[model samples]
Target: MKVRHYILLVLVLFTGTLFAADIRFTASVSKTEVGTGEPFEITFSVNANIERFGAPAFNGFQVVSGPNQSSSMTSINGNTSMSMSLSYDLVGVKEGEYTIGPATIVAGGKTYHSNAVKIKVVKGRAVQQNTQSPSAGGNAPAVSSAPSADLSKSLFIKAVASKTNVYQGEQITVSYKLYTSVNLVDNALDKLPDFNGFWSQEIKNNSQRVDWTIENYKGVSYHVATLKQIILFPERSGNLVLDPLSMTFLVRRAVASNDIFDQMFGGGSYQDEKYKASSAPVTIHVKPLPENGKPADFQGAVGTFAIQTAVDKSSLKANEALNYTVKVTGAGNLKLLNAPKMNFPEGMEKYDPKVTDNILESEKGVTGSREYKFLLIPRKEGNYTIAPMKFSYFNPATQRYMSLSSEPYTIKVAKGDPGTNVTAFSGANEQEANLLKKDIAGIKTGAPDLYKDEEAFYGSVGYWLLILIGPLAFIGARLFRKQQAENNKDQVKLKWKNANKIAAKHLAIAGKQLQAGDKKAFYEAVYKGLYGYLSDKLNISAADLNQQNIAEQLQLRQVDAVLISRLTDTLNLCEMARYAPVTGISEQEVFDKARSIINDIETHA
Candidate 1:
């Protein structure tokens, strides 16, 4: 009876597990084809309770009203189940084919992404762009045909640069501020400016929360949030255009009373409308640094700085360690400054300097100091003098180049132990032998030992061990051959076993291509590596495999959703880079990401 009970309990648990794994979270649209200005419904529903849900960005459509949460519970024959859904009413705003990306949800302590939905928008009847409607005609106020103009003026992002005209390598500040008069229901950043042709340093606040304040722009009061603050230094001289920052905002707009109760109470209702706000592109006119007064040794530093040098000790024994430091203190692109040149006397070994920065950024500008420490070793005893260090920078504030000279350092080196070995500097090959004195003794002077065998080779221990190796080798070879034969019997299993090797071979090719500066071949090899890995590991044919089935197969194997997503993204990037123009992600980066995804899949799945 106990055995039967255990068996029954095990069966019940197994069935419950299967049922739990059957949770279906899917996205469906009312119409796959529609006309421009026609509104449609898209619903994301799941059979099980979810913890978090994220709606996909509606790129080519305007959300009239969205994400209405509805839940229902049912019980039949003592079995209860619950389901929830979030639906959005979106209208096509552009006449083109578009795809709505996947929506994500967290359930059962795991996240899942729904399949993408595609929509085709064609020309439709002209719709009036009215912003208001009479409430007496209907319970709800009709949505305007055009929401961009209405929401753009209320909620938008403004990219503000401190100064547009400046010399190359001059420091400037650019801030992307979100100004809003309407209540923001939700928001997400779409794209950040690439900021090409410039070196950018973003100012990060201590807190993750946005600091909101009331600000009046163009005589209109609005709540503003500084989204991103960046400090940029132009790398070249041209009319460089600062790309726009794009974001999507769900705004709550005051609409006519949508309910009979609200209409009777003389109250207004609000509708959540989705609108995308892209900051206007700002052009910065960068001027070349003046060449007339520029110093010959200037290292492209455009800032005001003060240099100070110090030596740890002016006198030291030969082969002793010495610490020399150079510090530059002041503000204006201190982070961009290069290492100052040092002129140490002969017979001393100098090393690369260790750089340290103490920088602070504020509204006024960047202000801080940078320090470089150099390590030196004197090998011979003599009186040596280090030339006075010189650092020149083009100060945009003064509109001229200036140079600073540090006091010279004179050192007296006393001889120590002759056994100490100091490597020669530069190409002094003849002096190298004298400088390199090893502490250990030279090669053995006596002749090598050679003796006749004391015992017969037939009965020695080595002879017995060697005799045993022949039988062991034969047995090992036999077993390996048999195992290979069995593996060959099942081609599928062989492919599965060799999946990792095949991917690695392709990755090796991709690495070679990356070093050779072959973008096309590099991307192709990376794409093949990832896809071939998936094909062999998942038993899916490469030609027939698409993103949808790949995702499904990975999920069936119980791979983590996040890892699957990463694999998909890498595959997409590799494929896209093969044909289209992919920026911000380099070929090496794509290769690394692909290799990492394959490794992770092997590790986890």
Candidate 2:
């Protein structure tokens, strides 16, 4: 009887487990019919442990709040079940029928998709604001019943610029603020200014919630919040129009009623309505930099700037790599400026510069340093003077062209190994050239061992070993020849196969340098390792390799975006550490991160 009872208990638990473990992925919506410019909710849920999720494209909707995550777990008889969901609050921007595409999620090594949903939006009736509310001039709130034409004065968007008139390539700060005298339930961006003919950078707001403060605008109290701040630089001289910023807001207003049931059950009724607000178009008069005052070396740089040129090694072997960095520090259109043109005296191989930006964008404007790192390799031994690089920019504040010159760099190149030609090897760095020199066979020295032809010839162990070696060497040579032939067929494949191995070699050297407390050598090895790996994996020549190129190639290969960003950051960090003392990160950590980046690329590539 006890055995039968145990069997029954097992059966019951098994049934429950089967029921709880049933998995499903589905999409659900709050409502099918939504008024145009009104907001709604759509949620995608999966009854499994999710590894990653991809959101569907809402073609006609603007995302107000999105991808809010929630998870749940339940345990029955020690058998656990899991479920997770991602929801987005979206607003329809157009009056049309639209289909929300299927969303994808990865679970248990397989991808699952949720069903698509369709929604229809139609023109909505305008919301009415029941007159004026001058807070502190306190007026009781009234319910909105019908469309009111005076709603624009209650809630509006304003675009304020620091200066309406500015010179081309000069910096301008523009702030978009929201002025609302009435309450708002929900809001989403409808349209943002394109800022055409200008290079623009936004001041990023990190907070999730909008902090509103009470302010008096035009002698009326309203809640104000800055929505977006942008720093602009006119790319060309002319009249440029800044497009208006627009938003759709769900407004909550009180509705009065005289019905007996309403009076007995509640004091009043409230209604939620849809409303739209837009800022007025703004125009800026951009004047060209005065031709008479402009310096010949001006590279379209506008603002106050200082330039400094630094070379890591004044004297290095011909095959060794040299770091020539140009740092431009100041406020202005740094992003618009091009690389300073400089002539590298003949015999030097200059690769594309690795640009590093440490700029900060805020309401104050964009300011920081931009570093251009050039990896210069000298092929022939000689004395080279890279003329003092002259950087000039039009200073709007001073109304004059300012010129700054970096100390001229003197490079003396010594002869390297005759066998080591840096131009022939794209990935060769300083350490690599040394390794290449070591790889060349040299003459044997102090050889004294000799054996006479005697009894040691036949039937001896040495004789048998020598006799066997002929066949062994022949086999080894044949295998090597076959592999080399295959490698010669596709150079890309060859590089791909050897990329990780080469990266590992550089990392080994970096590790040694880290232990030896050599910051310069350590960072150089790390930088080379990362670049070498990318050169091999992406089939990009070392000469044309840069962060942008690496990102484009990796993205073409369908590699993960986050991994590409991580690799780029590692390269930047190594470059920065070579110049300045890196804080908050140890050499060991940097080494590990470089290795991990290589490993991750190998895994994903």
Candidate 3:
């Protein structure tokens, strides 16, 4: 009886060990490759129950649906088996190879890991046969019994250009349109073409909602909407290719749900299917301007343009400045066209031109006028004729060279004092004037007594002190002036050096406002403080500052991506708070965050 019991106990121990060793945790994906807009499922499965679960960081993808959990237990004969799975639906935001890291789960006071998975996101949706079912995996819900609709036939994007062949610097408009025959829940742009050899500007769409209209394409009626309009000007002469534009649309289609609970609770019997569409690449032939009639002084101005000139006053006294305005009006490349060269008479000093552009960018291309104001100052008394200034450009429409000239003006100047010139007498005159006011004694001709000279030179401490301090003072002054000169020359470096102090001053004022319970004033102060700090630190203009530009500038400085992302987030938060009403956020919290961001930037930058 004892021997039989020992044998039975040993067999029972062996069986327990075998069952324990069968515990396994693994991860899998519905598909290894997916479209940028399409959603895919990731499942973490184990044969045992977990106490805690930790997910991996999905860096390049956005989470669409969440931690759906399912478990099952089965008994076959005398053996029992159990399984649990956690699944997530995710959508790729960009096209690249991404790695989903291992997920951790705790079971029986021990941690278990799921294997990592790699996924490839292509530019467009995967091609599917008409007979194949659209439902990918068991985790996906089925909404109908019918097969999935044809995505390529139901949805598409078309890129159309106004002109394919154009001269360099001529304007071309490209329109991106979307046509669909199915119901679309939402759509988002995945990729915007980088016009490498062209200057491109987006024409803003005022209406936020997409206005769909019925249109016919290839004898098929479909709903169409204009997605975007871009105005591009080729910068070089060559066969330039415009890259393809890509977008993703979330489509709702009929599918049969196998789960009775899902079918009962869910209002509709449809599943969301993501479809991607890309426009065809376009080729443009940019031709160089004809050199036969190209003017030597051509300002690279293309398209039809006209020049108008006026002077604030045709006649002015000597040393007085006169405003001479040159306005160029019409369409095409107004921002890029160089200012017309002006030739003023001798004795008339001309400062740099102050250029102002009133160009309105639209589908018709850049239109409006750019005015160049030349401030001319007469230095001496004279009667001089200001010769006519000429501007030359090639008009692609006319297929010929065009020139516009400003009318000549005669100026009369009266005499002015010579001393009015700021550069006339600088350091030399000041030094001579100081020296002339002092009286000078006659030079000593006879030699002094040797003992007296020794007592004054060697025995006196004051003489040695003067000798030691004189050169040191001169050297210090010289170094100080040199440093001042350098600081004046490098304005960017100077601003960067003082950026922290300036930011601190602004923050201090913000703190005061926060203490006084002025919400609006506090937010405004914080916004200005942060903006000023970025402007000074990055040496960028306040008017031209933006999130995209800021990130680019930080990248150029070799700042880490995480730090740059934090800076961007902080700026965006401050901007939103400035315009919107303050709700749950505290002013002190914002102030602290701004301060922290500045400190981090200073440490890293």
Alpha-carbon lDDT, every model: 0.76, 0.76, 0.74
What does candidate 1's lDDT look like per residue over 1-605, in tens digits? 57679999999999899766678889999899988767688989998766568899999886654455544333322233556778886777778899999999876457889989999999984433322111111122222222546676777789999999999989999999878766665666677886766766666443323567779999977777777788888766778788999987666666776688888987776677788889999999999888897776676778898999999999988988788899999878776666675668877877766677798977656788989888788888998898888989988888999999999989888986775656444434334555455436688887766667656787889989999999999999999999989879987788889999999999998898789886766777787788788888888874346676799988988999999989877876675454334577777778778888888998876
Off by over 4 Å in 3: 1-149, 255-268, 417-605
TM accuracy, model 1: 0.51
lDDT of 2: 0.76
What is the C-alpha lDDT profile of model 3 across 80-149, one tens digit per residue?
A: 3456778887777788999999999866547888899999998964322211111221112322222355
Candidate 2 lDDT over 1-605, as tens digits, reads 57679999999999898755556889999889988546678989987766458898888776655555544333322234566777886766678899998999866446778899999998873322221112211222332333445568888899999989999878999999888766666666777776756656666543324566778888987777777788887766778788899888777776778888888887787788889989998999999789897786665788889988899999988878888999999998865556777678887877666667798887778899988888888887889899888888888998899888878878899988876673454644455566467665888798666766886567988989999999999999999999989768998998899999999999998888788887766887898788888889899875456676899988887889988878877786785554334555888888888888888878877
Which segments of candidate 2 are over 4 A away from where they belong?
A: 1-149, 259-266, 423-605
> What TM-score does each of the candidates earn?
0.51, 0.49, 0.48
- What is the TM-score of candidate 2? 0.49
TM-score winner, 1 or 3 = 1
